[model samples]
Target: MVKSFMTLAVLVLSAAGVYAQDIIQVQGTTPDLYVMHTVKKGETLYSLGRTFSLPIKDIAAENNISADKGLQLGQNIKIPLNGANFSQKADAASGGAPLYHKVEAAETLYRLSLNHNKVPLDNIRKWNNMSGDGLKKDTYVIIGYLKGGSGAVAHTPTPTPAPTPAPAPVNNTPAPAPVNNTPAPVSNNNPAPPIENNTPAPTPAPTPTPAPAETKPVASSGSSFESLYMQQTSNGKNATTEKGPGGWFKSNAAAGKYYALHNTAQRGTIIKVTNPLNGKYIYAKVLETIPQIKGNAGLIIKLSDSALEALGTNDPKFYCELSYEN
Candidate 1:
């Protein structure tokens, strides 16, 4: 079966490279007062930095933001050294492994990684053991964990305020009826405040009919049946000559970095690749099959933006071992 083609390469890297440190450097720019810029619609850290002529790392560090982190539509952030020319260095104080951002509404994991320049989507998923499911907004996943704590997070509830008590009512005696043909004056002493009548208000008019559902990309039945090592065609298509998931494709055939499938998606048996240091296993999921190619022994898979981040690839050419999990 075509499994992780890059597993061997990643193993070699593990032997020689060191885990990156978390730090960013201030570039060649000059500014005193920093403006707190609120992220607007369609705005990213790259675009923001470009607009203000600042380095991406500077803005991220100034605001304690991770590169892969997604910005809310109205979220406020610090704009560092605006209108300055600064170059970004990979191994600066703000260097090291890229930050992992949790998936959010109107955001695909790919979008986050592209904006950050280093973070990969799959690493974020694997780091959090996300089971390849789509990520939700505000869930913690790898972007700037608390200092000095292990990667694992302990769940805790947030505190809420207690409700206020209602005031008691005072008693009053009834007044005698007025004499015939005479109108009684209203009392001014201890007049009760206007009460919000509890009478049921008229039901609001029925809401207008909702608009039609938006259209989305649809893959065919064969698209989900390819083997684990199947690569993608240059035309950006994933077709297989084989009938099922038993065939193979060349490494880097997908053209893109990775292909992501649903965790519940069923296909063929995926090969197991193990990482020796942490004893972590990376499992490949076969969702389709393709024709075997010459010279390529293993299959290269493409990970989506979210998948890369979950797997913890802070830099490009996301290389990792093809290990299996129990």
Candidate 2:
């Protein structure tokens, strides 16, 4: 079986690597900001990096997979093409040991070690404490962690946002309750300043269906998305504005230098972050979304360790400010 798997891998990689190279399926899976690649039968992380022109460690870090645990067949893992350029030095910051991979079906001690750039199976057994060939799924295995942190993130084609549905056609024939033509005497209390209506004044009946406004990216604050988002969440004064109350962030993979985790910025959007305490700032592209989990509301945004250090420190929960120009 091992011999067959190896042969299959080389053959498929040799053939498919040329034609389907770098074709990552776009998955708008929550939180992540890159294309998703489904694990295939004859593939390993190393081969995947080769096909996509990325480093294996970057792929491991992106999904936070420990080398030993191994990928499951058909598992959907994020491909951080944008995360490739990051330095791997931050792996030291995560810990001394390499991140472990959780085992999945059809994975063996031999296959697992082979997938890890051919680390010896005996060493794998020694590291994880083993006595025999038997192995279990859903367990973590170490494949050796990396030393650098700033890995390269090559840009790939971005998928277009899903098309918005057309608005229902407005009926022009029925005029709005035919406002009385007769002039009325002016009232003393000039009708309280238009009552704060946000509705776009019913799109005058003249042009029955106005073309939808073209969407352009904008630095958001005061946009309705922000207004609605801010209404539900609590924050320090001005926290919701570009200036922030950010903290040190967590990433599955080692995020490249100057990358950040924001709850609202669209993936690939670049924003500037500042360490208010020291007045140091750097621009980072938005790489992933910080989920709004109800239990963890201490910080508004999180910066990668490299980003945190770039801003000058690695305080686990440090706070900072941010600015965006779309």
Best by lDDT: 2
Cα lDDT tens digits for candidate 2, 1-326: 99999999999777654432322232322223345666776667776676555678878887899755667887876765333321123232243223345566755554454444445444555555555445566545544432333222122322321111111234554565555433343454557556746556765665744553532222222233233333333322323346546675433222233555677776555565667677666666555566477534766676655666667766667676665533
Best candidate, TM-score-wise?
2
Which 10-residue window of candidate 2 scores lowest in summed lDDT? 159-168
Each prediction's whole-model lDDT (CA): 0.38, 0.51
Cα lDDT of model 1 by residue, 1-326, tens digit = 13465887777566344222211122121234333455666777777666555667887888888977877787777654322432223222132222233345754444443434333444444444444535456443442222221222111111111110111221222233334325434444324544424433533443333433331212111233233433332231432221111112222212223343223233433433222333332334443332244522243443334334334443334334442212
Clashes (candidate 2): 25
RMSD for all candidates, in order, please: 27.5, 20.3
TM-score for model 2? 0.28
Error of 1 at 223 (Å): 12
TM-scores, one per candidate: 0.23, 0.28
- Return the lDDT, model 1, position 149: 17
Report the C-alpha displacement of residue 17, candidate 1, in angstroms: 36
